[model samples]
Structures are given as structure tokens and as C-alpha cells.
Target: MKASLRLQDTAIRYFLEVAQIGSISEASVRLNVAPSAISRQISSLEDILGAVLFERQPRGMKLSAAGEMLAAYARKNALESARVVAEIDALNGIEKGHINIACSEGFAMDFIPRTLSNFRQQHPGIHFNLKVCAPAEVATLISRGDADIGITLSLSPTKDIKVEYRQPSPIMAVFHPTHPLAHKKTVSLSQLQPYPIALPEENTTVRQLFDICCSRLNLLFEPILESNHMASLSRFTAFGGGIHLSGEISMRHQIATEELIAVPIRDRGMDVRNIEIQTLSGRTLPNIIKVFLAYLIVKMKHEETIGF
Candidate 1:
């Protein structure tokens, strides 16, 4: 018996590059092949797969329905290939595989670095690709299969994905150490009313929680400064500008090093939100991810029990 030759791998790789670049010519340039040769390969792929992979457009080529399906399969194959290569590299005691992660700016800045540093030390051959986006954007990236894992706060678990809830982190009100309310161990919602609050824009989980808390206390809760970035809020709060609200895990270092104080809000009943680890449903996690997630869970548990 003779072994079978397969163009599936080759075709999928070619189309992945083409889809990424959106132009056969550009893909050829990147692939170091002639434009005509790339075109021939695409045509051959289409014939072999018995479906058209791209729709010609005046600007460039777009993936057709069948093309989209193939592209998805190709992406999964690419990830699996990287995983296999990483496993092979691990035999040499090197961690040389790529992991793409999506997280919010706060987590990326404060938490992920230490975790990744430890992960890197343990698996020196692993490469990391990180994107810092809003929680909703992170969710979208995970759903679209662009990210292998997502970490976010206050996210409602959805059936579209599998979610592992980490320990909840308290959302606290932060102010400059010298501020009037800084002396208090806990602050009421009415006490926050005297100061201008700098908060994330409307529709964010943090903002929504803030609003509900304010409404319950019959406070207006108008923000003097609105931003999407938590770091900006931290900066503003550090300077004695206004009160800013964030998770205790996110503000731990800032509170310690920047002369900022975090007072827990008691009256409004704002509960801690669980930071979630999310992935596409039914997808088997690579060993690297499994190890990393285990580490994350352990670390989060420690953080939850110990004040940061």
C-alpha cells in the first residue's frame, strides 16, 4: 500500500496567508512566491476542495462562505501545528510556542506580567502574543477565534463559550492618600457624593455598577472625567484629582506605591466580580494553556485570601 499525498495542508496555509493579507499579490510577496504562482495554488486548492475559496472584488478578494469555513479550519490547524512544534521543542527543554491572549488593560498592566514572567521562566520556549482591549472586545476576540484565551471582569457567562470563574475581586473606591475620605476604612455612597468621580464611560460593567449603587443611594453620580482606560483613572486618582473606582486586584500596587488609598464602599452593596477565564466551547486547550490556567487559578486564590 502507498501513502496518500495531501494538498489540504498546503492549500490551507496558502489561503490563511491570502486571507490575512486580503490580496494574492501581497500574500505572494510575504510567501516569497510569484503572484501567478500563488493564484495557481489557490485555483488548485479550490479544485481539490471542490469549492470556491475567494470572491473577487474590485478592491481585493474576500473569503466566500466556503472560504470562511476553510479559513476557520486553517486557523485551527495553524494553532495545532504551533502546539505540536512547541511540544517538540519542549523535548529539548525549551518553551518555544506562541499563545495569544486577550485581556483588559488593567489586568494586562497589573496582573498578567507577573503571571507571564513565571510562565516564561517555567517554559522558556513559549512565545506570547497579548492584546489589551475592553472586556466586551476581549469577549468578541474569543468568540471570533482570534484569541485562544480571554481574561475579563464582571462578565456574565454565556453558553457560546466555556467560562471558568476565578475568585472575585472587590471593587473599591480609590483616592489620593491626602484626600479627606482617605482616613476612613470604609466609605458610604453618600460620602462619595462630595467629590467628583472619574469613571469609565457608560455601558461598562464598572460604570453600570457605579450607577446602580448611586441610584440606590439617590445620588446623581455624574463623572467629571470619563475614560475607557483604568490606568488613566489610576493616574488621576493618584494626583488627588477625583475618586476612581476599580477592583482591589487592579489597584493593589498603585495604592501601595503611589500614596493612594482604597476605601471599601459598604452601603451600596457593590459585590466583588469574578475574573473569568474564557475559551470557545468544546475546544480542547493546549497543554501550555492548561498549565497557565492552573497557575492563574492558584495565584488568584492566593490573592483573594491575602490582601494585595
Candidate 2:
């Protein structure tokens, strides 16, 4: 019924705080207790366990071998304590929970915002934390337990993350509503060769794909305006700067408002940009995560079916 009792033991809590903070005064400040009290607690813990948990240093305290083992135990205990509290919350019909998600930059603008909107509407008590990084960094977030869920351009054969759902997400040629190429129902990569283009930076994954695709088709990509950020390119196209190429999710709202139009790029090599949902492999998902994931999958399916 309480908020779990795992770390309430004063000495254990003090040691954990010191171990986490690497300084007695810092731990005291964080715990809102006296420095002398924290030092005594740490000393008492050391005496009882018969382990020199920290090595005093001029810079700060460093964890000893014994301290590392105890720190692992403390971390495990913290997780267990959280599970107990979550279980109690569930038993009382409380829907409150927190979800951490990692995703590529595009999802931050449109896909994640919409998904969070729909999810929060039903479970208003729940909270969400979002981290946007490069597509390659998404898997690392999950594997390192930094994120409960990830959505990114497909990263197949992942190291420690598992793909739960994946669907085709082809890159599209985006341009202003009144651009010459906007009148056509579908646009190909070759059609834009004559005009100035806005392309992602040379080192980015999308740019690499564009380069490889251009090489395969013997098409030259010379961009007058080059940027690493997808949002900037979308802005450039919306203002009638030049045609840009990218996945459709980032520009969904703009396209809906007729600010920008997404025309299908009919290139075989660069067409495959499957959107994937991933989680840490062999990890049990929290209930809130499962519910949100369901919401996301439903949204993704609808988008695929109706081109949302």
C-alpha cells in the first residue's frame, strides 16, 4: 500500500546516495539530510558489511570493487521496489504510469505527437518522456534501458533490440503546393534532376541512400541548399525554395494543410524506408508501454491503410 520499502532502510539509502553522487556533501544535499548523518550511515553500512565501498580521492570518492557489487545490488533493489509500487497502483485501479520513448527526429514532429495525443486522451494520468536522436541511436536507448519503446527507420538485424512491427515507409519527393512537379500524381527521382534540390548532409543515412540510389540510376544530385535536419528541408520546401526528399511522416501536417506536397519517389533503391517499432529483446514490457504500443500500432496501420 505504501510507495514500496526497498530503499527506506536508512543506511542502505545513504550508501546508495553516496555511491550515486560520489561525495558525502552532495549526497547529503540530494537526500535533504545532514552531511554528518550521511557519513555516519555510510560508515555504519561499511562496518556491518565489512567492505570498503569507496576509495577516498582528492577529486571525489570512487567506487571500489566491493562498491560496484553493492551498487548493482542497490540498482536491482530499486527496480524491485518500483515493481512493487506499480503492482500496488494497479491493484487499486490507478492508471498512472510513466513511459520513456526514443525515436528518430521525424517521429518527434508528427508521428509521436499524434500518438501521444491519442494515448494521453484515454489515460490522462499517465506521463510520457520523449528523446529524439538519430535512427541509429534508437536501438542503443532501448538496449541500455534508457527507453521503453523505440520508433525509427528500419534497423534490421539489431544488436539487442527486437522489432515488433515493421511496415513499408517509402521516401517521397516534397515540394511547395505550386511547384511544377506538384501537379503530377507521382514524381520520380529523375524528374527533379534539372532543378536545384535540397538534400540532407553527405554523412547522413538518408543522404547516403540518396547517393547510392543516384549512382545506381546514373542520376546526379546537386543540392543548392543542403541541411542535416529534416525539419529545415521541410521548411525550405514549404517556402518554395526547392524540392526535397525525405520520409513522409515529418511532413504529414504540412501536407494536410497544403503547405507542402509529398509525391511518391519511384526509385527502387531509396524507396524502402520501413517504419519499425522496437523494444529491448527478451524484456517484459510494462502495462502502460503495452497499451501505448497498441495505440501506436493502430495508428500506424491506419496511416498505412488510408495514407494518413
The candidate that achieves the highest lDDT relative to the unseen native structure? 2
- Candidate 1 ranges with C-alpha deviation above 4 Å: 1-74, 215-218, 267-269
Best candidate, TM-score: 1
Predict model 1's lDDT versus the native: 0.77
Query: What is candidate 1's lDDT per residue for 1-308, written digit by digit as tens?
Result: 21124565665677778887789888988988888877887898887778889999988889899888776666666666766776777787765567789987778867888888987887787788899887778876775568888888754666456786566655788888888988898988788888889998775677777787778777886789999888888898887789998887787677668578888888645764667878876566677777887887788777777876
Error in Å for residue 75 of model 2: 8.7
Candidate 1: clashing pairs of residues:
95-125, 95-126, 96-125, 96-126
Residue 201 of model 1: what lDDT? 75
List model 2 lDDT by residue over 1-308, tens digit each.
22233234888778877876789889888889999998787776676677788999997788899887776566555545665687789899999988889998888989898889888889999898999988888887776556888999872568667888898877788888888888788877788898779988764557877888889989877689988788998888877889888788778789888888888877786766678899877666667678888888888888889885
What is the C-alpha RMSD, rounded to one decimal, of candidate 1? 4.4
Error of 2 at 223 (Å): 1.6
Alpha-carbon lDDT, every model: 0.77, 0.80
Worst 10 residues of 1 by lDDT: 1-10
